[model samples]
Target: MIFSVNSKVLEKVLSKVYPAVPTRTPMPILENFLFQIEEGKLTITATDMEITLRSAIFIDSTDNAEMVVPAKLLYDIVRSLGDTLIQFQIDIDNNKMQLSTDNGTYNIGYAASSDFPSIPNVNHDKKFSLSAKQLKKALDQTAFAVSKEAIRPAMMGLLFEFNIDGLRFVATDGHRLVRYSLLSEKSEIPEQYVVPERATSVLSKLL
Candidate 1:
């Protein structure tokens, strides 16, 4: 398969999804990004078994392909490249990815795409949208308060409480607690859930 994309554009997109990659794990497959091209768009996904993040970039492709490439290596290489177009050639049978730019060409080996973990499809019975600025502010204010202790399931992560009054986020590590609340003009949910610390870290980057 062959495709060409701008170096700077791709690098910027890669950084956004890099947080979801597992830096250390027994499953080596989680260290790579699942690269897929379909319907004329290229998508890269990273997952640490708990949270999965996907980002996309427009590309020039004649054939659709999917593969798994070393996340750190790929990100490091592309991030240093200049604002120029880079052509990518993947040899699925041999398990390799070849990148060619105006200045030079680079070749890297990759793992079997089939070995990448399957990303789950979530169906939330309820849904709500929050602005990006608000999300960033909320996570930043309360993330530090999340409990590090794992003994208590409730204290292990951030607690989100929703009610007619408003929405609230609570986090505690047994010694201290933090609460951040947001007002909702329309009341739709009265729910509570503990978002894992790892997931909150990723969400913070996304915002």
Candidate 2:
């Protein structure tokens, strides 16, 4: 199967998902991007098994095809190729992905797409929308005090509480406690959850 995409868009999508790709894996294919084309859209997914990332961008393809291409190599190739339309063709028999530009063509090792783990859908019925600035501030004021000791589940995660009044972020160790409260848009917010401290840090940076 063959398809084409905007190199920059592809690069951006890959960059967003690349963080989920593990640097060290027992199966080398785990380090690659699972590329799937269907219904004129191209989806790229990467996962370290704990967290998964999947991004979709429109492409000109009707036929369905899937393959795992070395993530780092694909990232490097597109980065070096500059801004240009990229052509991708997969040779299933040879287990290779051919990337083409006006100037050249390159081949990269491929693995069967069936080997990639399915990314779970994060279907949270309760989703909160908050300003990035407010979220960052809340995290900044609270993240440093988060306890690293795993024994205390409460301290190992950020305590997030919300209601019609506002939102609150709290973290505590036996010695100290830190909390940040923000007055947000008034609404019904019965949802409350403890986000792992590690995930809190990452989401904070992303915001």
Candidate number achieving the greatest TM-score relative to the actual structure: 1
Best candidate according to lDDT: 1
Model 1 scores a C-alpha lDDT of 0.86
Taking the tens digit of each residue's C-alpha lDDT, what string does model 2 give over 47-128? 8776677889998878888888889999999988889988988788999889998989988988899888877778898777
Candidate 1 RMSD to the real structure: 1.6
Q: In angstroms, how far off is 88's CA in candidate 2?
A: 0.7
Residue lDDT tens for model 1, 27-118: 98999999988878999999898888899987877578888999999999998887999999888889888999988999999887789988
Model 1 spans > 4 angstroms off: none
Instruction: For candidate 2, report its TM-score.
Output: 0.85
lDDT of each: 0.86, 0.83
Clashes of each: 0, 0
